[model samples]
Target: MNVTIIGGGAWGTTLAQALTDNSHSVLIRDINEAFVEKINKRHIHPFFDIVIPTSIKATTDLDEALDFSEIIVLCVPTKAMRSVLVDINSKLTSKKLFINVSKGIEPETSKRVSEIVNEVIKKKYFGGYVVLSGPSHAEELILRKATALVAASVLKKNAKDVQELFANEKYLRVYTSDDVIGVETGGAIKNAIAIVSGVAFGLGLGENARAMLITRGIKEIVSIVVALGGKMETAYGLSGIGDLIVTASSMNSRNYQCGLRIGKGMGVEEAVGSLTQSVEGIRAIVAGYEIGKKYNLDLPIISAAYKVVNGQCSAKEALTSLLGRSLKEERYW
Candidate 1:
């Protein structure tokens, strides 16, 4: 299959390499001309240590990327998805599939990536849309490490096509599901937990504290997911608990780092400035807060995360409040 990865960031470029290895022709498009030039000429994304094959075409033009590829792997971040989808919608014919790898809710509407795609499709032409998400990250995928991700679509056939698209011995293990709500929810909620875990690490809290927080974090996430029309079981899968474990435990997670900075007594603006990449949890917490309110979900952790990020509360205050919560039964069920 001919594929276009419509972003030039690490995830997009990394996926381009994976698709190329799968014996599919891959092209990557970046809005940044420097990133485009670097990938086209050097075959390596400047953000990573790995090198991609020069055979993968990298360009800045959307039309050029769309011209040959039938399946577009939308790897851009959530904030950029709207404009990018709008640009691509007119050009998309009925024959193509779009697989979203980006994770985060649209800030204005608090819609998931799949929702955004559905909205795009509703507004104009029809196209196959699916969201491929899980604990797998760009770093692991690019290195060809063992990884598994869900191929989620509203239509099972579209999910099946995505499963076939990336299933391979060299790169990824793909699972198909019509549970798009669960899959997308798992991807979005994990980042907030990761931020909390980051704060624990920065505060010199032991692994036990982080572990406890993460386990409870999963419970909070499951509540919100169920409240907002996602399956509780989905949170236990790769995109759910799997994602929580990876993002919360790893230093590579930008959200985790952002939390760490806040825990260390730095302001949100200061923390954001110190990091080069955008910390998506900053946006996700805000969206999650809105979702929690709209759905009447008890999401104290998500609320705390929003307060810390938005400067309404300090990280220390957030942690203290979490620890001082009213006694409740601990039910694993």
Candidate 2:
């Protein structure tokens, strides 16, 4: 199968290598001319200092990329999703299967990438939407390290199709799920929790604190998933607790790194600005706070993260607020 990947960034190029490894043709479309040239001429990752497969090609033209294949892999950030979808809609000529790889919810609207795709893309040109999310990071994935992911869609066939497209015997493994909401909710909420975990670590909190945050983070994720009309079991699966465990505990996660800086006395904005990559946790914090309010749910971790990001409280103050919450039954729905 031939696929066109939008946004030739870290994850995008990494997946391009995966596709080529599976004997599929891959074309990457990125706005950065230098990135395009690097991929096309040097066969190297734009952000990472690693060599990529020479079979992979890149272009700056969205129209050409849209016309290159029937399968479209979207790897851009959530903030750029709507504009890119609108651009694709204008030039889309036929039915296309959209595989969303970005993990985030829109700030005010709390819309997932799938929802944004449905709202922006014309129905006639839309084939299906599949979200591929899990504990896998692009840094590890580029090294062909062992990773597991879930391919989720309301359309089971679409999920299965993606399962086959990216799955391999040695390193990459994909499971299928019909619970799109659960998978998406898990993927987005984990980023926010990872930041809190970072804050815990940066404050010189021991492993016990990291464990507590992850356990509570799972509860928070489950509540949000249920509120969003997804299965509770999905929260414990690969995209939920599995993802949170990896993201919140690792230095490789940009979200965790951002929190580390904040815990070490840097301001939230400055910490976020210091990273070269997009920290989805900031947006996830805002969305989670709003979602908690909309559903009238108790989300202490998310609330603290929101306060820190919005400049209402210091990182340590946020931690204090979380610890100061009244004791209650450990019931997690």
Candidate 3:
């Protein structure tokens, strides 16, 4: 299938590179003119030495990218999804599959990226929709690490197109799921938990604490997932279990690193400014809280995360508060 990735950030750049070598006609769109020029000239994003291809056409025009496109990959940052979709709303034509690789929730709407798109991106004009998510990290994928991911879509053919298009030995292993809601929710919620674990690490907490947090976090997040109409089992699959493990444990995770800074006594704005990349957890934690309120669910950990990042509580206090919460039966209802 012909593909156009809708953002030219790190993940988008890596994906374009991977697909171009496979004989796919790939186009990448970015609002940044410098990014477009750099990729066309150097086959790399100016931010990093990315392994992109000269043949992978890069443009600043969404209309240009959408033209001759059968698959639209939503590769923008999680927080940027809404504004970008709103801008591209009129351009989304029918018969194309939309694949989201971004991971987080829409803060104001408490909607996953796909949900935001579905609500705003008039699907009747598009070819199709899909979500590609899993343990795969952009940096690791660029380095050609063996990565496993799922391409979830409401339409089976879109998922299969992604699977057949992305599978290879060097990079981007693909799987498919019709449970797009579950896969999308799992991908968004796990980053919030990863921030909690990262705070645990930065506070000099031991593995016992981090491990317990990570494991129980599974239960905590799964509750919200099932309550929101997602499959309980998807939480255990690549989009769920796979992503949670990677985000919570890896130094490469912006969310994890952001939490570490907060745990070390830095302010949220300061920590966020220190990093060049946007962290998904900053938005995910807040969205998780908003979601909890709408669903009337008790999410102590996520609640504490909101407090910690906003400076309402210190990391130690947040951890203590979580431990001090009222006890209840461990149920997954």
Best prediction by TM-score: 2
Please estimate how well model 1 matches the true structure, expressed as its whole-model Cα lDDT. 0.81
Instruction: Tell me which of candidates 1 and 3 scores higher on TM-score.
Output: 1
* Per-candidate count of clashing residue pairs (backbone under 3 Å): 0, 0, 12
Model 3, stretches more than 4 Å misplaced?
Answer: 92-95, 326-333
Provide C-alpha RMSD values for all models, in order: 1.7, 0.8, 1.8
Give lDDT tens digits, candidate 3, residues 1-333. 578898888789888877876889888899889889888887775566764667888899888888858778889887788888887777755556678899888888888877787777775765667888899778887777889999888889889988888888676678889888888888988999998888888899978987888888888778778877888898989999789999998888888898788888888888778887778888888988888888888788899998877779888998998888888887655
Q: Write the per-residue lDDT of candidate 1 for residues 47-143, one digit (tens) a residue.
A: 8856788888888887788887778888887888898888887666545577888888886898988778877754434567898888876777788
Clashing residue pairs found in predicted model 2:
none
State the local distance difference test value for candidate 2.
0.93
Rank the models by lDDT, top first: 2, 3, 1
Best candidate, lDDT? 2
Task: Kindly indicate the candidate among 2 and 3 with the higher lDDT.
Answer: 2
Candidate 2 off by > 4 Å: none
